[model samples]
Target: MATLEIKEVAKRYGDRTVLHDINLTLASGEFLSLLGPSGCGKTTLLRIIAGFEHPDGGQVRVDGQDITALPANRRQMGMVFQAYSLFPNMTAEENVRFGLRVRKVDAAEQSRRVLELLELVGLANHAAKYPHQLSGGQQQRVALARALAIRPSLLLLDEPLSALDAKVRVQLREEIRRIQRETGITTVFVTHDQEEALSISDRVAVMYEGRMVQVGAPAAIYQEPTHPFVAQFIGISSRLPARVVDADQGVITVLDRALHTPRARGLQPDVALHLYLRPEGVQLQAVNGKDPQSAVLQGTVRESTFFGAVTRLRVELDGGQGVLADLSTHEALQLPIGIRVHVSWQPDAMRLLPAELPI
Candidate 1:
């Protein structure tokens, strides 16, 4: 395992700039994920780290050694792409041994390593099968085994499971995590799948248009997003128009409404603000009941959809504040559709975002 450091990295294609002053430090043996939408330069960043692409500026250091000038093959990095790039003619065992053979490892040691890796990936029995004889998931496992065979210092995965079916993707993702944990190799995984990043990564870097918008644990990024773009991108968070009517004593009044809540003090007053709340944070109650400790929104349930585990309701506030609330199926069993109910949320569940970003 090796520590990976990227400092002031920038990339450009002719006149168009793709990456700008990117800086990150990855701990050794950590499962870090680079997450973003398409064209966000995540793959470009990964290629730069793997020595497949060069940066126009800045440096890349691995294990305290500057490797910005090294070729991809000399960098001792393993890479797995979205497509399983396996040798078509060779059997699984032979394909995995290709790297060892290239380095002139003895036959006895090569056989032992191949058997170990095939067994490690649960492909020992299928070692004789060629790439065309395996399923998508099986082929990917073979690819992973082949990548690990070289004992590379860093493993770079670029959407390695995107080509699999939904069920296979889920299963293979877990398998990949298990393999990574057992091997303890420093890895960098790049993907556009938010759920995959949130579920698998020890730390996630949320990139946007070539810059990292947010970087933190999955829970922190989802619950306490520092940016509006992050709050809107990470999960199902709704933004309502608000203003900081009272910035003293850590209190703020929800503008256009009579609700008051405690917030971070020292924000500009009477300015436009966005109040973020997650779907699960909102609580629904019968119209006859009252909850004084909660901030209430009087709204008729505009639409309700059964989602097996949860029933989602779209509520439109009387003053035009729109929000969505999710109730568990068991909780919504007795409630009917179109029922006018009071929707409320705790004060702490609301997140505040700047009206105009300083950046």
Candidate 2:
């Protein structure tokens, strides 16, 4: 296992910057995911780490040794690209053994290692199958086996499961996590799927535009987001405008309702802000026979989306502001379209961001 360090990494093309002074460190055997939308520079950073792309400024170090100038072949970093780049002429076993052969390992050793890896990825039964004969998931398994056959100190996976079907993606992600744990290799995975990152990674780094915004445990990233982008990206959230009514006590006014949230602490009075609330945190109840005092916000159910155990309802408030609330299927059934409802949430379940942002 090796420790990976990226220090003050920066990249630009012509007048536009792609990454700005990015810095991150990975502990040996830690699995970290670079999660963001398209063109957020996550793939670019992975390419730089794999020695596929050169960084204009900053160094990439593995185990305290400078590897920024090292070529891809000499870096001993195994990379699985988005596309499973398997040779059509090669069988699964041969694909897994290719790296060992390239490294000049003896034929007997290559055969032994290939069999072991095929078994590790649960593809030993399909070892002799050609790429064209195997399913998408099976081909990806071969690709992973090939990457691991080199026994590289670091592993880089760039959206390796993005091409698989939903069920296969779930199963393969679990398999990948198990293999990483058994091999204990420091790994970096890049993906845009929030659920994928949250379910598998030890820590997730959320990137936006070209910068890494927040890095933390999956639970923290989802429940205690420090950035507006992270709050909106990790889950379904509704952003509402608010004004700081009392900075010392962390009181903010939203739609004539004053709520106190720790996230609003230290803001100057009269400061405009954006309040972010997740769907699960917003509580919605039927307005029929309900006490008016309990209704902090009133709205009409505009849309209902079924999602297995929970259904999300989009409510259009009195002033035309819309917010989302997730309720159980049974509860959602009781509140159909055109039904009036009241909405409220606990104070700690929200985060605040400055109202002004780049348009």
Candidate 3:
């Protein structure tokens, strides 16, 4: 329902800084997620956006109107916390109508809105149930309904699904996405769960320490991370040591095989580098013949673990380094432990970075 702009937001407590010149924008009706590990300032940024925490610097704008100095209650932002903060004495319908009652809405309007919200969240049949009578997922649905009852301009979800069971978490997340889509309320979700963020968000902003390292669509963030930290944080990758053969041409030599890669800024020839390869990108072949165009490294299968449709193999390279490879169950079953094999991947499937690059 509204566009959000955060410009040069900075926050600090005592001698430690929690946020550093953070800038982000969200289009109207867009679901943007702030993803990071603990103490990464994601929750701080969310609180700032909701007017719950005052920033030391920068401005927050909604539809070009500066709301940086506004109090939390006047910001028209609805918040759903990880804990379902429902009134234990109140039923679902009463809980959903609490906001409307506080706003002095007429009794008829409040009743109608309560019924509408309960129906919207698929809990109309359980409107009379108290907090103790509802499951975790049902409690979260009530919290969501209460947040929406005010028809806020923005929604802030601070790991709203963290308290639910795994199966219920997945179900509630899908339901939240559906509700967000139907209402078209601009939302900012803060979470450390990568799968939850990747599955539900239109864009993901990965943060580290006190800074945002990367922001992109889920697929782009996962497939082509621009920073070393982003590459390591977004998913699992095997780092293999290499040496730059040609910086200008983006060439590197790994396991005695020269391979071409995307040019990295400030890289010099002969310098040590790291080649990051995703598990899915590495292929296993029985060492019979070599492909002229492929970059292959000889290794022996050290261990293989079957995982339903796919099997993950830990291949130890000749020099004692290890790389993971994922193969179909049938293909992996053919190569047991101690089986000599060749591990190869396309040049473009790996990212080459300076070995000294700090994560």
Q: What is the Cα-based TM-score of model 2?
A: 0.96
Local distance difference test, candidate 1:
0.87
lDDT of 3 by residue, 108-190 (tens): 99999999989989999999999999999999999999999999999999999998889999998999999999999999999
Clashes of 3: 0
Per residue, candidate 1 scores C-alpha lDDT tens digits across 154-207 of: 999999999999999999999988999999999899998888899888899988
lDDT per residue, candidate 2, 1-359, as tens digits? 99999999999998899999999999999999999999999999999999999999999999999999999999998999889999999999989999898889999899899999999999989988999999999999999999999999999999999999999999999999999999999999999999999999999999998898999999999988878788778987898999999888988889878776676678888977888888888888888875565457889999999999999999999889999999899999999999999898766667887777521
For each candidate, what TM-score against the reference?
A: 0.95, 0.96, 0.95
Residue pairs with clashing backbones, model 1: none
- Shift of residue 300 alpha carbon in model 2, Å: 1.4
The all-Cα superposition gives candidate 2 an RMSD in Å to the true structure of 1.6
CA displacement after TM-score superposition, residue 269 of candidate 2 (Å): 2.4
CA deviation > 4 Å runs, candidate 1: 253-255, 289-293, 356-359
RMSD of 3: 1.7
